[model samples]
Target: MSKALDANNRRWSTLVWGSIPVVLLAGALTVDHIPGTDVRLTVPYAAEGPGPTFDTLGEVDGEPVVDIQGADTEDTGGHLNMTTVSVRTNMTLGQALGRWIATDDTIVPVEQILPPDLGEDEVREFNQQAFVASEASATVAAMHYLDRPTTVVVHDVVEGAASAGILHPADRITAIAGKEVSTPSEVQDAVRAKTPGESIEITVERDNEPHHETVELGENPHEAGQAMLGILMTSEPAGGVTVNYNLNDIGGPSAGMMFSLAVIDKLTPGALTGGTFVAGTGTIDDDGEVGPIGGITHKIRGAEEAGAELFLAPAGNCDAVKRVHTDHMTVAKVDNLPEAVAAMEDFAAGRDVPTC
Candidate 1:
């Protein structure tokens, strides 16, 4: 009886030990954070002729237009490049572990990347709205640099927001409370001055005709005692100059600064890039303010791989910039559009520039 019991015990121990390896293997393959990688930035000027992506300024109504140069210059070696990150979603446990071991990529919880309640369609819609906002910001920046009048227009209305049914996409908000506004902050201030649930008069220009609508203000979800209209706004050229951005599939406002720079480069004479490959990522506003963006480390890697010698990083993102491998590229910290342009000019002139 004692011998038989010992044999049964040995078999049980062996089985338990064998199962440990399988469990560990399964855990290793489990999902973790999304992986981010570099995507090449394309300049729209490289496109054939003027269309949805490229814009060429010409005489409008017999008025002389800006003499834009560098469309045909072959030796113009510089590029106003934008940066993007490749996200790896629903990764297995083993794959996540591999990414962690590689150290070249980052791991983030799924919830951190996206809200748990958001569906795929909602996410896509959000991305599309972001793209529109970026285009508007870029257009405004360029128009501002050109000293042209611009207007802040509604790009997309957040679903379930106060303005969802009251406002539509592409509707240009001309004024709030009978006072004309041009920038987003002005509109916000106009709304914030009012109490939540108060009705405010909003004038929007659609199809070249003005229409007035009464919108009830809603409480700002982020701030207490603040009123919000629940719409995404963008800048549009009030003048005859038109800027059309044609990059498809790519979303987010991170490319705003780069797009603005690209437009400025095309509108002005000579190469703003200083004849060297330059890449950057930042959210630009109509007021020329630069805002921080995510996936900057991945963008840095992308710029480095694309043969970019200079990188323009938003000042707010210095911490992430410090943690990334910049390799041989010079990373310059910029707070606004003017500073960015100056840094690029300084680099092209072989002068020392600011670095983060």
Candidate 2:
């Protein structure tokens, strides 16, 4: 009898604990799925909460129209401030069901369905996962596109960097620190031989005329005991190999996807834009593959608010993204730009978008 009672008690405890989530889930689903109801809830920890999508007051094609600003723009909608319901549902399913079941309609809401606003604990976790996934995809694409580093010949020196003026983007450095160079490796070796605060003369050719400029090196960047010039050099694509990339004003590691796409698009023919205002956030590789991004749901909400007709997301985020989808926008899950482009074309043609 005692053993039976103990087993019964354990069963009751399990039933009580398990029912909490089930009941909450059911209630939330019932409310969210119903019609003539607004599922407006506050996301406390969200970076930018729901608001207008317009980032800047600008014009495209010289026509007066709103333009989306760079990713760094502060025009993002309002962020969730606290862990509370900012507004109540117009007709919550939970409340409606309870009203139908009894004379007195009293519905008890879930205790912790959503996280705290700006919840660093949870947001940090999500960022960590997102960055890891993005890094892996970026690594793969870079390896494919930048397979072998090539050298570019400096032809002109309009500005003398370290000597007097700026170095033009197209100018090539033939030799550094008085060393003969034909490849990028040789230039690097010559530069590496000099110590910080030392002056090095870089030889270059402009219009078949050779010239030299002396520059003082700066302290090591990021790591100690190393030397740097604090400037990036570029050259023509050698060996018939080319690279394409997309860049934005927001300079961070997160722009990997845009950079990759920009590079690939330059290498390929035609423009990616079909004359539509489509904004996206994701990491791209050198191979022109699209990868997952962080804060996708928030991004989706932002896209919808911006009047975007379609959204392209990573395949891995499809399931989670689907759960948060609204009828106001279309989300297309894809592993690369090719798939994403196809989806965009379909959406343009008024075809039904496939869900993840």
Candidate 3:
């Protein structure tokens, strides 16, 4: 009996020892944190090319007051490329570990990429809205450069909002309550004057024709006693040159600067890119002011990979730009559209240009 009991005890000890390796291996491989690196995962780059990208503006009503030298030029010059980043979600333990160890990829915290209380759908919708706003801003910047008349229009309708079903995206909000509203604030104020659940007549220009929409005001979720229209808008020329963006599935405002450059290139004579590969990312406004965007380092990688010799970065992003190591790519810090254009010109002319 003593021998049998001793043998059982030895077997128990052996089983406990054998399980240790499996437990350690499991712990090593377990995904304790969401894994994704900012480094290895490069955001896709799109240029003004054959597919969905910047294209030449079609015929408009009035003749050009200012003569555009290369207004009719075809795809002779190289394209101004825009950079984008892919948002990763639900990464596995192994994938996260791989990214963490990878040299090229930088680990991005889960919170930064995915904010709390926000779902993937919400993020996508926000991106889509941003994309629309970028298009409007690009159009405005292009028209502003060309010295043309423009108007502000509704670019998107927020989901689950008052105007979601009533007002469509890209519907030009011409007037509110019989008053001409040119800016987004004006539209907001017009809506604010009315009570929630009240119906107001809004005039919009769709497809170059006047179409009126009667939209009911929704209560502002954040503010009490405030009316909401649940739409996103940007300033656009009332009768300006039409610039069409063919980017499909790619969302976000980071492409605004590139889009504006593409428009300028198509409208003016000579290559805006200076016959060289140019890549950039920034948010462009109607005033031609370039705004900072996220993921500058990743974008630099993308630009470098695309064989871009020159990179146009927003002035606000210079601090971040300084930290990123982009080999053989000269990064120029630009504050506005004019500066970007000048940088390209200087590059083409072989003159000393500003660097970040």
Question: Candidate 1 regions off by >4 Å?
Answer: 1-77, 152-181, 184-206, 209-233
lDDT string for model 3 (1-356, tens) is: 69999999999999999999988756545544424634333222211111122222322234321223413534436647777665454655545565556645556666676566777789778888888788878877877786766676777789999888888888888899999876677888888899999999999888888998898889998999788898988786564545556665778888888877777776667788778888888998877899999888878887787787888999999998999887788899999999999999999888878987
- Per-residue lDDT for 119 in model 3? 78
Q: Could you say which candidate leads in TM-score?
A: 1
Q: List runs of model 3 lying over 4 Å from the truth.
A: 1-76, 154-233
Cα error, residue 240 of model 2, in Å, equals 13
Residue-wise C-alpha lDDT for candidate 2, range 130-164, written one tens digit per residue: 44444434433533464534444533333333433
Quote each prediction's TM-score.
0.67, 0.36, 0.66
lDDT: worst 10-residue window of model 3: 42-51
- Counted clashes in each candidate structure: 11, 18, 14
The residue-by-residue lDDT of candidate 1 on 286-341, one tens digit each, is 77889998888878887787777898999999998898776689999999889999
Return the lDDT, model 2, position 243.
33
lDDT values of the candidates?
0.75, 0.49, 0.74
